[model samples]
Target: METKTKKTLLPVQGKILWDVIILSILSVLCFLLPFAHYTYHRVQWTVSGLQFITGTSVQDGEVVIASQWLLIAFIAAAVLSIVFALVFPKIKKIRLAGFLIILGGILELLFSVLFTMQVQYIMADARNAGTSYAAWLLALIAVITIARGFHILYKNKVLSPLDFMIMPGCIYFLINNYFPLVGIFIAFKRVDYSVGIMNSEWVGFSNFTYLFSSSDAWVMTRNTILYNVAFIILGNLLGIIVGIFLSEVFSKKLQKLYQTTILLPQLISIIIVAYIVFAFLSNEAGLINKGILGEGNEINFYNTKIYWPFILTFVNLWKGLGYNSIIYLSAIVSIDKSLYEAAYVDGANRWQQITRITVPLLKPSIITLVTMSIGRIFYSDFGLFYQVPMDSGALYSVTQTIDTYVYRSLLQLNNIAMASAASAYQSVVGFVVVLVANGIVRKIDNENAMF
Candidate 1:
């Protein structure tokens, strides 16, 4: 029985060993394949990975040296992977072998990305210099090697079933959330499509100066921050009121109907909502203009700037109220009914019970939502500011926010670097605001603060 078990295990171990050796060899071979394709002064050419490592001269007399450190690191990782695979199993360090393989795969993958970026930077002036399929194939092999390493770890009991279950989500989060963070570098670059984004010249704070130097900066900043402030205060206040009202309703059917009716607007597309606002506020053939004010007495709501602040505030509140109320209502439902009953027995009226019992207990939820809102105070609802106003130039004074300004700049100038700078500014400021707000909350009530 022991001999049969040993024989069966030998094939499995041999298969894993062979897989690592083959992948390491293939990674080394990939360096001999075409790594980049380029066109210089209307002449096309391809450069192999080995040429990139050894350094090459382009048509324009530019000496292109893709990072020597990265090339050396990649070669070292591949060589070490083969050596470890052979030696570790002999020493019975199988788990250490798996870790080394994982490290090697990560180094190869990092080398692929960094090397391509470096190549693009060096060949920036080329008409269309780009990474070839060999680089991507190397990256794919690196990914496979990583998966195999993880499998070995699992077999050795280094990883749990739950780790495998969460692996997909972790990978998705890295690709979707963390990977795009690299674009933050664009804010500091003067982007040139011919040279690609990574190769663009650095301009320090020049991109940011476009926002601060302009007179419109203060107006847009005011509009964005004030509107968000109103939205946070009034949205939460009304949501709590409606949530409490809904909780008190005796009829379940009527409550559901009310809930559905209110949430309908939240579900409506922003474009449709904009049109709905236009239908009511339009100067010609509008419900308000024709039915109430008459034809000649029409108020040019879109052209007039004074009414917009209130109009926008109302529209935003109306549209978002249902969704906000549902959140508070869910929190309200989870409250102990015994508290409200006890308050009633203590001779507290309905209003007093709400103020003394319901609202106080809802503190944690309110604090959480408010902290989250503060984190986005620098951002604005672009549609609410732009589309609802019908893009009337007359209302630019009141309607302009950071988002709309960046959008208009993008449309008119097509300055992606400037747009990226504006976004980075908002993100950084919003992050600071959230930290400040949470710190204040923590000072006031440590338990309720969102850490």
Candidate 2:
């Protein structure tokens, strides 16, 4: 006798079919519920169904009232979505359509809970006595439903394979990084903490009034631009020269030792090194005083703001040059030795070789480093400005950049929202600078332009 066989399905293969079946059941249960509902209240004239939908309190003898209209609306949306998805599962656009429906359901459920409490609080205000929120509840239902629809549309999307890999990262960024990014709006607002993040009324660019449409704007702007310009040009130049010289000067036996010596300061935190600098620069019992100069009363370096630009640049070079040089070292070492040997055989001097072979060969590394560094031009190292200065008021004039200004403001205001806004502003300005710099590079040398 022949027997008919039943096919077995795997987990994923069975899930869609099961979802469709469950959705059918849920849709039937949900669609049958009444759209309008009523509640009873106490501590006042006994209230019943106030309108098409009502909001009230059902406290003690007074029963709390809630319509759950938004909840019903979401359930209705979800039910309609299941039916729609059952009809069209393969269409790409339906993915977005279906997501919007689920989003609406979620938002409606959320706001329904929120508004329930709000309306109850307003009505139950013993201060209001017999005041009722019946009309307000009806209006809330309409507003919430519409808000849910807009929010749903905003939340919908189509995910691809790449998005699957990046979705978790994207979520992390949205919460940790992007949400803080919204603080840029504060830069344009006369922001205060009273109204909180969203409900604050707009101020029509009053906050930026401090930055643009002023004269001191040019001072800060010029200082930021020129300081970074000097650092990039001077930093890379010194780093490359040092890297090449060290690569040549050290014997193979001493190479690691010499590299480590150059790199040792870099391994230590900048804050720690700033203290070391303090020891050297201390006005009393300092090594520079007792050991070197032996001068009486010593120089109060902190009070002299005129000397800071040079001192800060020097410190930056000492701490950062080795690391930057190491990057150039990788490029230097990878250069073809045959070119150097041929030049040597042709009687090329070391200086000539550097001019012809080294500089030209290092162009790619130069452009890459310059491009990356340019992206940070509008920003400054926080530790250098804050810790190195020991937060002295004396150095505030020359040392204050956009970052330091923000830090000082936050310290004074203790408002995290404004801090976030300042950070967002720095990022945007830095990004703009990089793009403009890249455009200039592309015009000058397309091959070396980043992107």
Using lDDT as the measure, which candidate wins? Answer: 1
Q: Relative to the unseen true structure, what is the C-alpha lDDT of residue 374 in candidate 1, on a scale of 0 to 100?
A: 90
Question: Candidate 2 on 165-207: residue-level lDDT in tens?
Answer: 7757965875687554534766555555564444466765555
The deviation in Å at residue 74 for candidate 1 is 6.9
Candidate number achieving the greatest TM-score relative to the actual structure: 1
* TM-scores for every predicted model: 0.79, 0.65
For every candidate in turn, the CA RMSD to the true structure comes to 5.5, 10.1
Give the per-residue lDDT of model 1 (tens digit) for 306-361.
99999999999999999999999999999999998888899999999989988998
After superposing candidate 1 on the true structure, give the runs of residues whose Cα lies further than 4 Å from its correct spot: 1-29, 36-46, 57-133, 145-177, 193-196
Whole-model lDDT, candidate 2?
0.63
